[model samples]
Target: MSMFAHTETNARSRLPGGKALGGLLQRLGLGGRGLVIAIPTLWLLLFFLIPFLVVAKISLSEAAIARPPYLPIWEWDDGLLNINLNFGNYLFLLEDPLYLSAYLESIKIAGISTLIALLIGYPMAYLIARSPENQRNILLMLVVLPFWTSFLLRVYAWIGFLKANGIINNFLLWTGIIDEPLIMLQTDFAVYVGIVYSYLPFMILPLYANLVKLDQSYIEASADLGARPVTTFLTVTLPLSASGIIAGCMLVFIPAVGEFVIPALLGGPDTLMIGRVLWDEFFSNRDWPIASAVAIVMLFVLVIPIMMLRKAQAVEEGAS
Candidate 1:
């Protein structure tokens, strides 16, 4: 046997718990592969499933003035167990136009931001992927350089550029492009800019990773077949890179949907988003049950896109 296998067998023999665990796994018709899967399964159970269940429980509870700020769903009275679940929180969300509007606006903003990032990042990624090996690293470094700075600072920096008397306006005035400073700050436009700017790297990196590994022979073959460059790119390159595009868009969209800082800082009062609504319900209003309900609903809303992404990934894998 290999040294690694020998050591593993000896360790299992020496450790009673390991031996018992192995035996149990064997009886259950699981083996080394199951052991590998178990780590992530346990991690998700502990971190994701448990926390989600906790939030779901809270969503079914009533807001309270006491500690934890939510009433328990379960109670014991006269040695009998009683269970109460409040569905009013979800109903309240549906009844409130503000919540619905916020949800719509959040989705709209995130969607637009993701599209913009894809547009900007796709060319950058293509260039990087096609570049000489030595220059590729430098270009990639520049793409990710913003992350080296604090995210808040980067958003704040945009304020300096987007404000009426800020860098952009000043430059436009100096260049005689405009008569006066344009109002860009504290607007949905600024929020879009922030989201696109901050998440561009997320879009670019995935595309670059995908494009770099792409078989150039496909493109060359298309060209040899007398296909025009644009046609080849449209039919061949873009189709192959669909997975990367979806991944990048999802990365940008998912976080952008729940983004608090960008909207809170750059967006005007008119620019209502679900994240702001969630913050208000949780902190400003101290309505834990409502907040939990909003969170749960938002999660459900995100799950649709996540499921679509998973399906696309599965299809891609099957095709490969």
Candidate 2:
């Protein structure tokens, strides 16, 4: 009897849940691949899609003097269901020229910052990628060293450098390059400088990753074919690193458009950005509907560029 019981236990262990769980999964058409895909899908649904839907709902509601500060979109009246959705919040945005100017200015600033980062980062990345094996790790570490320090502290340090009678102007004055201090603080130029400094690593890391993997043979062959250095770079290296350029630009531009701290601290009143406007709507004015509308529009604007970049990257990969 003990031997029979032991044999039964082994059989049950081999079969697991007696094939019930396996049969259930098979009937649901959920294989190992499906389970793996479900993780990210579930994550997005929880964190991204759910929050977006909530904001979207708020955007369609009317502002009110209540606990939530927005009128409910639906109500019950005489046993009949009634639904109310307010789109005036969006229309009001179009009617207001301030919002338009804010959007345009944000795009302009972010675009310029991305361009500056690319120009500065490309050379640094190329140098690091081409450096000796012993120095490569150290160079990469230096590139990311800024991240170890607090981001806010770094921005504050920039303030000290850019302020009148600060480090830069003082140095210039001492060198007799200028008789007086330069007005560098609270300006658009200061905003650009701060953004490029903060996001330069994002640009360089992608470029270095892409450039390091590039085959030396293509470059050598080009040089062998009587191509000059510039010609070889323009034809071979540049084309191959297009993916990195797109990725880095997208990373920098997206956050820069919604940047608030750098602009608020470094930029003057003239520096109009959507992020600032959103803050005002949400906090100062306490207009939840308008703020939600502005946020939704901004998301759509950023999404368009992201979709375009992704499509471009896909085409590039397919061609390669």
Candidate 3:
């Protein structure tokens, strides 16, 4: 009754010669819930769905000498629309061992990088989460301080540090650790280092968020039960933070899979990734159709991990 009275009063409070906004919204079939849902639906349709459709269309087309450099898959002839899709692009990708190797190598690199990030980030996140309240903020700020610098600048800075005559080598040489400078730049080592450095924060932040909210009573109960720290962590803390691990791994792995700059700049000729292949096909070879196909394939490849993450999240939510 009170809600009804409030609604009636709201409807009656419109300015002179003004339509009731709530009634107008109701007439357009857009209540609060409807507006919230419709806005995001329209946004996805306009952006993601539409762009994916464009890419899918181009992927079905053939390479041409025209300005856009790709032939349309659909055409009108004799007042009838005709569809002519060239599946050769996909066929070519299947037949090419290079694309297959690149895709596999990309997955391998991303997976390895994600694991390394997790190994390094988990301890840091744990420390921060367990830190005294007075010092936690400062530690967290330190963890995130690297982001204040430009990412490109940070990557370039690593080049200076990893080069043959770079700071690392100079320091080592001065200390008589080695006579020759280490071959760090333009190697798989450099690529791994770059990926770990760049994505470490991504891994840490999620783990911290998960860890900070963990119940201390669980740890205390395990201690009272005479469990060692390692056992307690493995049996209790680790299980509780599984969601963070999944979240962090997904965050690091997804972007790392499609990373171009890190591999292009820090990796050697042997370190061929799908991202580099896509870049070469599009800009270097001017094969827009093939590039679109590569992109589509990459999108499909990423879908599995994304679905797994979603499933994990759903299970976690249900359990909670």
The best candidate by lDDT is: 1
Query: What are the models' TM-scores?
Result: 0.85, 0.86, 0.87
Candidate 3 lDDT over 69-157, as tens digits, reads 99878889999999998999999999999999999999999999999999999999999999999999999999899988888888888
With a 3 Å backbone cut-off (N, CA, C), the pairs that clash in candidate 2 are none
lDDT of each: 0.92, 0.91, 0.92
For each candidate, C-alpha RMSD in Å? 4.1, 4.8, 4.8
Q: Candidate 2 — what's its lDDT? A: 0.91
Error of 2 at 255 (Å): 1.0
Give RMSD (Å) of candidate 3 vs. truth: 4.8
lDDT, candidate 1, 1-320, per-residue tens: 59999998888788869878878888897788887889899999999899988999999999989998989999999999999999999999999899999999999999999999999999999999999999999999999998888999999999999999999999999999999999999999999999999999999998888889889999999999999999999999999999888988988999999999999899999999899899989999999999899999999999978876776567556655
Which structure among the candidates has the greatest TM-score? 3
Residues 1-29, model 2: lDDT tens digits: 99999999898889858678867886788
For all candidates, the clash counts are: 0, 0, 0
